[model samples]
Target: MSIQPVSRERHAHLRWKGFSSFAFAASTTLAPLAAAEISQAALALPLAFIERDGHWSMAAVLGLMPGQNLYVDAGGVWLGRYIPAALRGYPFLIGARADSEPPPCIDASSGLVTPGEGEPFFDEAGSLSPTVTQVMRFLEQTAQSEATLVDACETLASFAVLEA
Candidate 1:
């Protein structure tokens, strides 16, 4: 995949308690791209870190509106350890079509679908009802599949929000 190079000098500083980190956080800029890719509005914008080249690399694929606790270090050293936590509490999704079985659920209202199953869910902001349970069963039966329940949950959550 081609990536555009950014710069540390142009990065923003995020202050948390007595500690501070430098990174970039912009949902408006990348959210649309993700939405287009996933074909859902409930895509999760997982945490990302600024690489040495100043380009962005996702630290982790956070599920639907996952809390700040899910945020973790991107496994880097020194100054490069900094990662943008702004999206920790923000909403993001996989923004892609499911390639596995037990397809994610969707909110008829929002017209968005969860990325997969076994993913996290927030409040009504992103909820999965009967559909979620079915997805769960599918995940339990499948083994060694690249697909994750979390991805399905993210897909459903995305759809819910889109309908809302």
Candidate 2:
């Protein structure tokens, strides 16, 4: 997916329309896995824990096919107890910068974004609205957790407990 940095100058006038269905996720082959520290909270869910290329992750196993998600109902609604934080923070993502802190980025193609509709991204004062602030916080936490997961996986691989 093509992601662009979210900035007041660019996105101030836009609104987050909110996704009406899970069709976008249903079409994807895989979803982002929770970090090891947070995986236990989702253990009872229907997803499967998988480790690939030294990265410990999870995947929703719908069927025997490559790209299938059974959790998606007839109306494209996800039927699971815990939604992956990655998916919950739709459209917005944390992107690493070359010489500055990572900033929240938005998938330009996501249907959740619009010129006029739904929750406003910025308030009348040209500042981020509460909804946008919450999303940014979620993305920040997700990025930090992902980094920790990568480090933990690397350490495990060094000890021969995980395969690279």
Candidate 3:
């Protein structure tokens, strides 16, 4: 199958309604950083690139968010080496999955975001998206600079798929 260029302009704001201690921190902090909400529209065609059964024949939601940046390692791990001071207080992973798998979960008292609910999730990629692979590729190209958290956040924002 031909690889279709994915658009990365679909910005969305995910109102995390799940329960978590981290929720409080995100709401208090991220709520202010967010600019707009893509809750009313779908991702652009380019960013809408999907492959199910070797073709672009699938139904999904693509959303976005503007807040703390996130980054994942080349080996599907969140590197917690150099987190920004602004986001250090929060539970942002360096290279980790965004699903509720335990250590990655938001503290009930802090905040909570679930895949397809508050956070982004790919049924095929789990909490990761095709963009994750793209980010990994980008990381591969530029291995000098430590992976930027904003890179992951921006990419994740471009692929935040909402549920029907």
Name the candidate that leads on TM-score. 2
Q: 51-129, model 3: which lDDT tens digit per residue?
A: 3333221211212344332333334233333222223223222233358422222222333333245533222324444
* Winner of 2 and 3 under TM-score: 2
Count clashes in each candidate, considering only residues at least 3 apart in sequence or on different chains: 28, 0, 28
Off by over 4 Å in 2: 36-42, 46-64
Residue pairs clashing in model 2 are none
Question: Relative to the true structure, how large is the alpha-carbon lDDT of every model?
Answer: 0.28, 0.71, 0.29
Off by over 4 Å in 3: 1-91, 95-109, 125-127, 130-164
Cα lDDT of model 3 overall? 0.29
lDDT by residue (tens digit), candidate 2, 1-164: 77998889888888877677876678555555547435644564455545766576555454346677666776879876666666777777878788998877888888778897889878999877888889898778776776676676667667887653
Give candidate 2's root-mean-square deviation (CA, Å): 2.8
Residue 101 shift from truth in candidate 1, angstroms: 37
Clashes of 2: 0
Instruction: List TM-score per model, in order.
Output: 0.15, 0.80, 0.20
Minimal lDDT window, size 10, model 2: 36-45
Top-down lDDT ranking: 2, 3, 1
